[model samples]
Target: MAQHETSGFRSFIFSRSGMVLLGFLAVAGYFLWEEHAAHILGYLPLLLILGLCVGMHFFMHGSHGGDHGSHRDEPREDDR
Candidate 1:
């Protein structure tokens, strides 16, 4: 007969103590979010604007081919 082996972390999480710890973390996170809800909502607009600016800065740049000088050296369709 062969015995199966489990990792220490995996075994602990499947045990009772890990379940209690996970429950405690869930309750704590719920209360923390409840208490700070107003503060987080107050910054929502600013966060959205900042995210838009950063997204546009990164995404819009890709519209142009990255080669700045090489295009000038390539023959134009008119030349062909």
Candidate 2:
């Protein structure tokens, strides 16, 4: 019997449309959390936003610059 082909996480992460949609959702979530839930978070929106930005930055850009920290070393704009 032939094995079924499955992309699993790769399909979701590598899709251009998925990335664009995820980016939009991230921005929208940030705004909603900042404007609506800041008081609930003790007004730590700046910290949250900074942390999120840093995390995404590290995920998308860090490994591309010869950094051995990332698990998935996908190609970046510089390599194109």
Candidate 3:
């Protein structure tokens, strides 16, 4: 059996620019919480639900529109 290679945290999770973007988001989130906490908190549930639905759609629709190569490259004996 072949062993699976795992990537390090920075390389796998986020690139250098991604780290900066995350930091910016953290700062923005803090400002939002400080300035508009009630409004942002009220919208949080809707944003979470929207993200979940979009993620589900992408995950359910696999590679090449859910084909997953179930159909053979060549004809089989079962085909008439």
Q: Highest lDDT among the candidates is held by which one?
A: 1
Minimal lDDT window, size 10, model 2: 63-72
Model 1 clash pairs are none
lDDT of 1 by residue, 1-80 (tens): 89999999999998999999999999999999999999999999999999999999889988686658877899999999
What is the per-residue lDDT of model 2 for residues 1-80, given as tens digits with 9 covering 90 to 100? 99886687778866898899899999999998888884777758778999999999989886567646564577787789
- lDDT of residue 51 for candidate 3: 100
TM-score of 2: 0.37
Among these predictions, the greatest TM-score belongs to 1
Candidate 3 lDDT by residue in tens digits, 1-80: 99876677656457877788889999998998799988889999999999999998888765656455767676788885
Specify the poorest-scoring 10-residue window by lDDT in model 3: 61-70
Against the true structure, candidate 1 reaches a TM-score of: 0.70
Return whichever of 1 and 2 wins on TM-score.
1
TM-score of 3: 0.40
